[model samples]
Target chain A: DTAVSQTPKYLVTQMGNDKSIKCEQNLGHDTMYWYKQDSKKFLKIMFSYNNKELIINETVPNRFSPKSPDKAHLNLHINSLELGDSAVYFCASSQRGGGSGNTIYFGEGSWLTVV
Target chain B: SQQGEEDPQALSIQEGENATMNCSYKTSINNLQWYRQNSGRGLVHLILIRSNEREKHSGRLRVTLDTSKKSSSLLITASRAADTASYFCATGSNNDMRFGAGTRLTVKP
Candidate 1:
């Protein structure tokens, strides 16, 4: 069974469209995160939630929002998506927040294409 | 802005050889982790080195962190074709985590 899984593995939307990617973790983790890997392969953190509480929100644009309904789920919603928003989004979970020796598990990634 | 940046961008190695990649960061961190991502797949955690630690090892992988230099390195021993992937170094801070641009490694059969 997959420890962390995300839906909408591939998404293609026109500019200004709204879209959402759903993520879930069965690993009994308390910390969940959203990371985006751009065309240049630079992986950047977007948001982090610990036990369904928003903890870290990077300099991501206001068009992007992350919601955690519960400790096991974290969803990303994008409004008015732009061409620059096209990238691979990954959902990950860790047993705890950032600290020494806490391994984070990543999902298979959701590829978003904004045209 | 990205905190860590990998050197050499890309590398090609022959099977049975060893591959090494380096990463440099701009700020302090609690720990540094190395991850591997096969083409079009998710990233898999390889190894982690704490700020107080100098080196750590896993099955066929070894990671070393030099907090003083704000850098880290990953070494894969006896590499196989299956080891072909992009390797990234992620630095974890109190607030969040940051990943490098990744080093694309190709292991020739």
Candidate 2:
């Protein structure tokens, strides 16, 4: 019954390792997004998908890729993880592709720590 | 990068008082929204003020937007200890919604 959910609330991995975070939204939304919040608490957008179509891909590193097998799920996979990759990743969703006063729902956030 | 930076990184208030936090953005926005995060929990949407609207209210929450100034403010009236949480302002453009660093409010009992 959760609107938006993410797996592995906390993740720890060594440098050069690979990791993946799964996200799902049961709100029947057409827009999904991935956001990263650093230790400084600056939340930034990484990627966005509208009904399973890649829409907005920010200046994120190429090593990181977002895969959406369906409209309800958006997974993030990190390759050659670096120490800087340690941050809180949030999954969010909205009813439409643009903001028309539509509120976006966020998950509990996946805390990733690359040692 | 279309980042909506919230001012006053932290705020501390006492019960029965009011709390106000401000956010400023550099680019145009379709709509601005406010969210609340209760510690380790997920962020909950508090309110959304569209470009055409000047203000919106929801229970104890009040949000005011001024697109001319490219800024917005959230005011919480009759604050309580339960209001202790991080408040963030997010602006959505197209399919992307960017969040600020958030204002960590500590409401003392």
Candidate 3:
């Protein structure tokens, strides 16, 4: 079974458009995260949800919102998509506990492009 | 902001040669991890080394951590073309993890 899966693998929309990417993890993990990889391959954490509760919220713009229906799923909604929002967004999950040994499993990532 | 920075942004090596990537981070960390991402693929966890541990090995991949220097290095021995990928170093405390820009490696056969 796929450990972590995300939908809308490829998305291209015009500016001011809104879109959503859904993610699900069958790893039974408590912590889930949304990461953005820029064109230079720099990965940055945008948000983290533990057991469906917002745990970490970076300085992401208000246009981007994350929703977690359950521990197994976390979704990202971007409104007013701008050109700067073009990047690869990844959904990752990990067991919450015992320090940094918790290995994270990442989905295939959703490629978002705004023009 | 990104906390870790990987050195030698890109590397190209011949098959059977070794490729080494180094990472340096700011502040203290509970542990450090190495991950690999193939072109157009998801990131895969390679190995994790705690602040207390100095070195760890997995197959031909060896990871060494130097907490005193706040740096870590990943060495891939006998690298093959299949081993070509971007490698990232992540440092974390208890619940938070941050990744570096990553080193792009190409092993030519």
Candidate 4:
């Protein structure tokens, strides 16, 4: 069974359109995170949720928002998408308590294309 | 700019040879981790070394962390063709994790 899973493996939409990506973790982890990898392959952390509470919120634009209804699910919604929004978004989850020594499990990733 | 930048963005080696990649981060971290990503796939966790731990090993993978210098290195011995992938280093402070650009390793037969 997959530990972390994401929905909509590929999404193509036009500008000014709204889209949402869903993520779920089966590791029973207390923390989950969202990351974006651009064309340069530079990975950037967007948000993190601990036990359904928002933790780390990066300097991402307001158009991008993350909603975590619970510890096992975290969804990302992008509104008024721009051409620069084309990239691969990854969702990861990790157990709490042990810190960095705790291994993180990643999802297959959702590829978003803004036309 | 991204934290935890890797060196030698690309490397190619024979299947029997060893491969090493280095990463340097700007801030002190609680721990550092190494992950491998196949082409167009999600990352696979390889190893994790705590700040107090200098070295860690798993199967044929070896990881070393130098907290004083805020750097880490991953070495794969007796590499195989399956080892050809992108290796990334991630540093975590608290529960937030960030990854480096990663080094693409191509192992030929």
Using TM-score as the measure, which candidate wins? 3
Compute the lDDT of residue A27 as modeled in candidate 4.
91
| Candidate 1 chain A lowest-lDDT run of ten | A95-104
Candidate 2 C-alpha lDDT tens digits along A42-109: 78899999989999999999999999999999999999999999999999998985366788888999
i-RMSD per candidate, Å: 1.6, 1.6, 1.8, 1.9
Clashes of each: 0, 0, 0, 0
Q: Worst lDDT window (10 residues) for model 3 chain B?
A: B91-100
Each model's lDDT? 0.90, 0.90, 0.92, 0.89
- TM for every model, in the order presented, reads 0.96, 0.96, 0.98, 0.96
Model 4 alpha-carbon miss at residue B47, Å:
0.4
3 versus 4: better DockQ goes to: 3
Docking class of 2: medium
* Residue pairs in collision within model 4: none
lDDT, residue A104, model 4: 80
Which candidate, 1 or 3, would have the higher DockQ against the true structure?
1
**Pairs in clash, predicted candidate 3:** none
Q: Native-vs-model 1 lDDT? A: 0.90
DockQ per candidate = 0.70, 0.75, 0.68, 0.63
Model number with the top lDDT = 3
Candidate 1 chain B lowest-lDDT run of ten: B90-99
DockQ of 1: 0.70
List RMSD in Å for every model shown: 1.3, 1.2, 1.0, 1.4
Q: What are the clashing pairs of model 1?
A: none
Weakest 10 consecutive residues, lDDT, candidate 4 chain A? A96-105
